[model samples]
Target chain A: MAEAEQVKVLRFWASPWSFRVELALKLKGVPHEKVEEDLANKSPLLLASNPIHKKIPVLLHNGKAIPESLIILEYIDETWTDNPILPKAPHERGMARFWSRFIDDKCVGACWMSCWTEGETQQMFMEQARACLRILDDELGGRRFFGGESIGLVDISASFFALWLGVLQEVAGISLINGDEFPNLCRWIEGFVASDVVTECLPPRDKLLAVFQSKKQAILATKSMVY
Target chain B: MAEAEQVKVLRFWASPWSFRVELALKLKGVPHEKVEEDLANKSPLLLASNPIHKKIPVLLHNGKAIPESLIILEYIDETWTDNPILPKAPHERGMARFWSRFIDDKCVGACWMSCWTEGETQQMFMEQARACLRILDDELGGRRFFGGESIGLVDISASFFALWLGVLQEVAGISLINGDEFPNLCRWIEGFVASDVVTECLPPRDKLLAVFQSKKQAILATKSMVY
Candidate 1:
């Protein structure tokens, strides 16, 4: 498995999912070529590589494209095998994988939850999202990180709360990840951003805020246009 | 590692997630014991095993319990050096995982989209669910199965869609898994149900449909009572 040819990753600049793959590659200390995809006009290579989702954070190891951010993380962890992302014990590893998947499934697109719903409906899902955060914060619960001690796979998987999308609370006008409320998660976020790996890879705070502003505007525009 | 004891899994009756672990176990031909959880009150063992979710299916390899359906699936594949549920190729394996996670994330509650919402709100989520199903159907286009040829982890992972909750479509008065539109998927479903591993483990369809019906009615009754 160690021919060790250079790796290539197709990614979007502002996507949290893309950020996940980027963080993994950097943590594993793997050298990778990054190709950014345009959402409006996707590249042919991106399309060909990921014909199904036709989305970004597709890792090409020796010219084969792998879609899905979590999958990419797993792939990176397996390939490098040092500074292991997932726990070694099969069941422990499974617990980590489950939570990571839960985050991706339940919380990954929460920034978009408000965008996708309105009135009472939005309120319902928003409450559901808060409960998810509460559970996550509980999961963090005095731990230095989700992996505990060193920031590992699940922490990287959930770094969205640590980075850009966290600012969406302002844009969406929801205060879910409150520091006083989710004390452990708040500390976890601080530790995550403070880490050398995260600080290096994270987009500038102002830039991320601007992205959130634009996305919020777009979402409002979607509803506005519908009306 | 070679001397590690065989794995065992804690599970619940009528849990699709448990079914997920079961299928993965059978597919991989992993040597394991299945401990069924009593959801009526929950067992102390189950509580200790999955203190977080207090749920099943939890995978125990060498006496550690791993919670969450998807995570257990990964653990089974990893621990058992038998038939691999995940692919040997890293990226391809990621794709399998990604799809499985997508199914896990999007397939909420067996049948109903929203028990509370009425008119446009429910309609919107219904559209979203349709979009998801459309994507899954397209991804499974022209293939013998989701895994291609033989049933793999993804097929086992998503088997709930075919057997258990497929009846929920009847309960919901919505038929998203249309045989005519998704002919390949329909064929795959039939093939899966006919398979020995899948067939032996499936809850009787009549029982499943009855439970789903009772559950749906309960949801409706609870909503009505609240109003």
Candidate 2:
């Protein structure tokens, strides 16, 4: 008898959270099937796996379902120790968690809002995004990546900055960063996108743009109706 | 020459987050001094330790500071090893993080709102609170604690319900749960509060009542001005 097939990921193409787990698995050389979820009409498997949130990027490992991107990242790191995501030192691990969480809590939603709303609301979110970018740029501190020499947990956690934010900004007609404004982040994003694993797993830019373009139109239409 | 002491916590007395770290340290028996910060006028140490969030419950270990309660709990569990907060199993640890993040993201602020709001707003928040409590009750499912037979990370993460939620409900004159509605949660709270280490560190209910009462009054006053 052979060992059981171990891993599977339920994901949506355009979700950064979903992409986080996908990238982690790819980087770790974990062989797993990707089940693309239709967010508009969620699959039974996705719902059953994550009944609490009914959200995707749920990693099914050895018959257990693990949700939340950061938690999944930790699970992958712990389960497969080779090519570690988090640093071995407790303090460094703590800092990595701090920045990763900071991105999730502060930057991600604000980045979304920056791309969706209009007038004062959009401006406010843009400012929030710019402020977050400034902080992250400073945190990068001339390093090649958030984890210093190479991409690690913090870098993966902030991967949305490289792909999603740029696409969303273009689609929403908002400009939060420029090469001059966030030079360190600009350099980091270039290196992150250039990485083989990341480039392989990232959704194509054109497809991402098409999805967000439609989403933005829907948001603006809804806003107009409310006004 | 003597080696310097290792652990210190920058905390504010009334903060649930600060209480979380305190409880974890006490349970782990990691001896440390507590420096209470004035939240109104945050100290330079607090600001320096957690420059990004600038919030309390910053745990300083041998000159390195780890902010965020859940992160600090992980750090404590990793460093101390004895009286482990999280389970050793990968899947169990993943579930612990899932529920912990769920409570942090969903329950805490909504629980606060359920207490402070009035009329329909209060009613809506109370419904949200009840829904969360229901999920938590089902999750508890006859276990003595969220971590099962012993107090663990999930149990500690939810320690708020034992102390603060009861206080807040009393202060706001709203009842989200009765014994009949959420038997597991009621039992869990009683057990949690009665535990030796929890009882030892928990702030006196009367003092907690005083603080929340004033805070509730302020909220109502602000609402009046807006209206």
Candidate 3:
């Protein structure tokens, strides 16, 4: 019999990017240990494993370390083989990768920025964030999820929109995805959260909310000092 | 015989991103049509093919468009597997991707920024750029290219370092790579350009230099006005 592969993830609890790797591992049923890190004071293991970026989350599998959430997800998919997160067909896979990149490029920063800015700057980023979500909503288009019926790469890549949307919106005091406006996206979010594997690994929402709430207070304090 | 796959690339003249797709096609012996776009006046085809980003270097294969350079390179590699750009082993491929992304995310912008800034800022970015190149140089070790004897994904991904480095350095009046400083990188550049397929598709360095020279003048003029 073959020995079981040793797997571990160095992650920070509040990070959406870290959440991506966690979800991918759970979805693929790849059992591994999790080493939670404090962003303020990173561990030596994380510093060594991901010396380049020095950021979470880094996946340590069988003595090799893979950093970057998207890269780790791909590694997980390739290693596990079953419960594939990515599409099989080459073109479909390209499309899936495209949207995932699109979300990272277009949406992630703007979503966070919308939460941190004020007045016209806040409105501008909020509108930009909305435009991005609208495009995603359009992509969802009558389907149950981005991957047709199941949560696949793009869906997992954009999981932040589903899980963290409410907390981000509440803390930021900005609403970008009301059901009436982004109906398909809202429907998809419900399906994503309700999915079996997703439920198993999702960080408690209330805890996530508390984390973001404190972040929001920090942002407010910093802005007050600036003004 | 089955019908030949119709491959067309929509590209701007001087984009390193476009060069990536071109090199991939050539390396794989995939014959394709090139549609050069006036970036100032983007063609409808470019816009239609890549509606979201409206960026150049969109690869149209059998009427289906795939945007983003890295993604297109992967598509080209997958479709035409004779000259494999990515490694066969999944772990090696993951490392290849991680470095490619590291270049895009960390190096490219800093390389360009080093050129356009002056005084402490330029020095800072130059150091950053050198630090990145040093890491890459260390990766190369004594190998002829990033992928060993022959050029592969990491080598192709860092194609900008080979061709654009001189032009960018000349235009910006900055020197990031030299014989003593990045010996392995310097050695790799000589090998990369000498490769037949790369030489065939490489844009004329003189013309590229002229373009950046004019752009630098414009930047200087704008800065003078602001000050």
Candidate 4:
């Protein structure tokens, strides 16, 4: 009868952003092909699909490309009505969007910069990151997940913290999250990674560590060359 | 009979962020009370309503507060379900959200910083802002508005460019938008502000200029003191 709907994801394997799109598709049970890209030499398709940002992961649905992981996640949820990733009520949906934006605006950048920086700059970022984590911890409260029972928009938006941040901290030789300081967030991370869909989609931990370590070494090499 | 719905907006008159919320509500014909906040001394209601960011433009609907201008726009659209601000199709909605975010994440900071800084830093920011505007101009090619035929999400999200940016550029003695470079955007800005609803809600041009002029003077005063 009708041809199967064409769905594809333009992704880079090591990216948490790309991982978010994969995880969302799996959660929704949407069948899609994956086109891996060499980020250094980005594919024409990737460039064409997302000319504005020129970054992954873009969700290609029947030739229509939707870029930005958070936006893609919303698109996926809207397109496939099953396994709703956002809350049903309008107010709840508003809160979900707000928190997801917060994670992107405040938490991710601060936490990321904290790992990549040094001295007073790093300390400032570390403090900022901690403040963000404290707010998130308070928000998470006693819920099983940020989405409450099942992973939802905020959790998917926050996939970076669930895995990448930890790996990044290790690679950068710093510790931002621990049981003593952020028990709620640590527990949420453990439960989040252990989930079936997330576990399936996440890149292997050691491989991720190796990638970041090498990148860090390269940064050091570049610094020395400049000096 | 049940009491009528109470919709209120905690706002700062000069703030573009607050302006977006008020404009959206006006577009949808949603009646709302404005609770003006003094930036120097924020009210307890404002603080409690938006603890996470503690910023202006919080929407209070029947006592449920929604923070962040973009998020609130979505909420208003969902709850009221009339005079739709976003598009009908999923892909279009995704694009609208994408561009709105791009304006916030890239254009706003660069354009604002270009006005506030000088010398090498100002030049750097000005270039970044122009590059972003060029992309936007190309995207808008021949379309009457970003939403096409009517004001929608992107147009609303880009409210800054329509009014505030022009004023700030004049105050700072820099020219970013003109007939030659950004003809499409210039046209869009003219049409956008000329709209009845936008015209009604916009802060007085003279008042806006005076506020920015004073603020710029304060910044210069501080800089001179530091030097």
Candidate number achieving the greatest lDDT relative to the actual structure: 4
As a whole number from 0 to 100, the lDDT of residue A151 in candidate 2 is: 82
Task: Indicate the residue-level lDDT of B64 in model 4.
Answer: 97
Task: Report, in order, each candidate's fnat.
Answer: 0.97, 0.91, 0.74, 1.00
Residue A188 lDDT in candidate 1: 85
Give every collision pair in model 1.
none
| Model 2 steric clash pairs | none
- Full-model lDDT, candidate 2: 0.87
lDDT tens string, model 1, B133-187?
6677788888877888788778887786687547766766766677876677787
Q: Best-fitting candidate, measured by DockQ?
A: 4
DockQ class, candidate 4: high
Better of 2 and 3 by DockQ: 2
lDDT of each: 0.75, 0.87, 0.86, 0.90
**Candidate 1 residue-wise lDDT, A1-227, digit = tens:** 76868788888777778889888989888888888888778899999987766778789988877787777888888888898988888756877887886786677555457445778978877777777788888887888988989878889888777875567667677666777877888888888899998888887888777876776667666642110
Better of 3 and 4 by lDDT: 4
Q: How well docked is model 4, in DockQ terms?
A: 0.93
Per-residue error (Å), model 4, residue B4: 1.2
Candidate 2 lDDT over residue span A1-227, tens digit each:
98967799999878888889999999899999888888779999989999998888899997799999999999999999999989998989989999999998999878877777878998898899899999999999889988878789999999889988898779777788788999999999999999999999999999988887767767666642100
Model 2 misplaced regions, further than 4 Å: A221-227, B1-4, B221-227
DockQ for every model comes to 0.64, 0.89, 0.79, 0.93
Residue pairs that clash (backbone atoms under 3 angstroms), model 3: none
Better of 3 and 4 by DockQ: 4
Models, CA RMSD each: 5.1, 3.1, 3.3, 3.2
